[model samples]
Target chain A: MNARNCLEVLRKIKDVAFATVDEVGKPQVRIIDVMLVEGERLYFCTSRGKDFYQQLERDGNVAVTALTPEFQMVRLNGRARRLANQKEWIDRIFEENPSMNDVYPGESRYVLEPFVIDCGNVEFFDLGVTPISRESFPVGGGEVSEKGFVISDACIGCGKCLRGCPQQCIEEGTPFRIMQEHCLHCGRCFEECPVQAILRR
Target chain B: MNARNCLEVLRKIKDVAFATVDEVGKPQVRIIDVMLVEGERLYFCTSRGKDFYQQLERDGNVAVTALTPEFQMVRLNGRARRLANQKEWIDRIFEENPSMNDVYPGESRYVLEPFVIDCGNVEFFDLGVTPISRESFPVGGGEVSEKGFVISDACIGCGKCLRGCPQQCIEEGTPFRIMQEHCLHCGRCFEECPVQAILRR
Candidate 1:
């Protein structure tokens, strides 16, 4: 479809997969509720005290995947940050999603809830870039499971999967080790490897 | 309709009403091309040194409305920000709409083209604040010019419309003025307004 058409499709979807990298160069992925999208700015509220926020502060770069149940996918690569600790910001989010109020009671507690949106929360790491449309995204072919068989040698010294591993079954030594029993078979490590070092056996 | 079904309906539409503010406290509204939507993020590109980006940066808050030719409406509110300026970022956008490359050649010159998206661009800006919904957004309001209109009171003195204005009809003053004659009536100012003070006259 056209560019406007692509946006229309995106405005309809809700869930997004947010991927982040930590100081140690480990990747973490989480399925988050998208709060809003304007222009190229994508906004979400997360706990500033959480690892995600911490990782963001360290490295604002991030990738967000927007997929429709019908198989339409758009991958957005941008940056994120914490906007404000003001009560007005917290109240705005609470007003939009009152259910959040149940999770956070007082304004003091609310400020602690991470009511940050992109307005001031984040800025684009790349200032002179345009937004990509859905058709151009690397047309992902298959869905990778959470866990996969690991193969050594291809490791680039970047420990992405090791950190993404939900069970922490993968170990990082000279070559790294995978505690097979501790592995939940999510295979996320295999899927996220930049060099495809982790093989599904 | 269910959210999924709602998206399906949203996919069939074109032409969105965007509301933003100009520099002199005037509200501007218009319909512009929506590049793509992934999750809550709606991607679009404007000139690097444009009024739209200036106002957007000043205030990330914005409202976007898209209506289907078949009488469906989708409204979103979120914070806007420029995406990172990088080759990969620009390439991704070009991948989607190759035609953009024609307008913007790949190079530092293209850096003047700014990619923007809104993360806080949430749906239901007035869901709890006022009373609005899928029906109230004027889905079938046919033939209404998708032009930008800006009122003076809310204008933040950003002066964005002067350059992008096809007719060069925008005038900046104590309260920004739009020369109705030279105006193409393509309400970019209204849609780009950070504040909602702009409305159809």
Candidate 2:
């Protein structure tokens, strides 16, 4: 899909999942009500001087994920800058959500930051079957694993390792199941398991 | 920054924080290495079939934050998808990481997915600046607190709250310190504090 079409799909979706790293190298995740996407960038509002804001200040590069029940999803990567002082800009953002006015009177504690990903660099992928998908284009890195990832004794059911899996192969419950059909063997789940329950089969 | 440049920056950054929610409406946070960035999309491999992935499938809107010492940071909002059975696309993604050859070889237990955000919907901000910003248009949000947030008696000091604080205002030492200068009043520290110690005064 072209950038415009891809963006339209993203904007229509409401719920999103965002991923980022902290100074300590640990993955921190959160769910946001407002995700403002514009131009070659992604934008949002949150309390200023918060850990997430602090992290954003220290690092501009980031990844964003948005999902919808229509089986639509969007992920974007870019650099973020905080608008700790742009009232006019902040006001424009708050206008989108009247509810924000009830909570943050002046957006004082709020920060209006925009994450710009070079649209020119953006790679687009649409689920389902599409005649125009460049799915054949080499993705990025090397193969993760051909075989299914091994689940060690450390499986905690906390469900943290689930995000690392792409093929929807890792199952929860007593013993997490690795569906062979969906498994991509990326090893991301294995590496991210808090207890090291997953290993190479 | 261009997508390539943004990717380069993301690659160099060591830690990133990922945010997601469970069925119960509670937020979960973690850190991970940003696997890849495509166009306006960002990709990370997760074990298919896990709760996180399931959650992503059900709800994709998410918030991500990255922190740095240089006081530069990036926060993102977007969506995520699960690569059902696109071997060709997954293969392309795998080609980007040469290290996979040494670790997981030929194995493909992962899924390939991407996210894209609307350009016109994006907003930008900066810390130590005017506190808010948007496009060259007019906005209408109120200001957050400036006297600094409040730390209630519910202090647990799990130090978990500090993870979400951008100002590093909620210090985890002996007794946490809320630095007013850095505090943006995002109240994330307060919202995430397990004991509910932090608050907006």
Candidate whose DockQ is highest: 2
Candidate 2, residues A1-201, lDDT tens digits: the string is: 544444455556533435455554444454444456564444575555456666666765444555434333454444556654566556766777665554345423344443333322232433322211221111122122233466766677877666555444567877676665444444577767788787775
Model 2, runs deviating above 4 Å? A33-35, A83-85, A106-123, A130-201, B1-201
* lDDT of candidate 2 at residue A33, scale 0 to 100: 43
Task: Quote model 2's iRMS.
Answer: 11.8
Candidate maximizing lDDT:
2
Evaluated on the second chain alone, the candidates' TM-scores are 0.50, 0.51
| Worst 10 contiguous positions by lDDT, candidate 1 chain B | B135-144
Model 1, B1-201: lDDT tens digits are 432233233334423444454444333333334655554345665543334545566765444554443323454434556677646556666677676554344442243333444333122111221112222222122121222354667766677645444445568875677765344334555555566555555
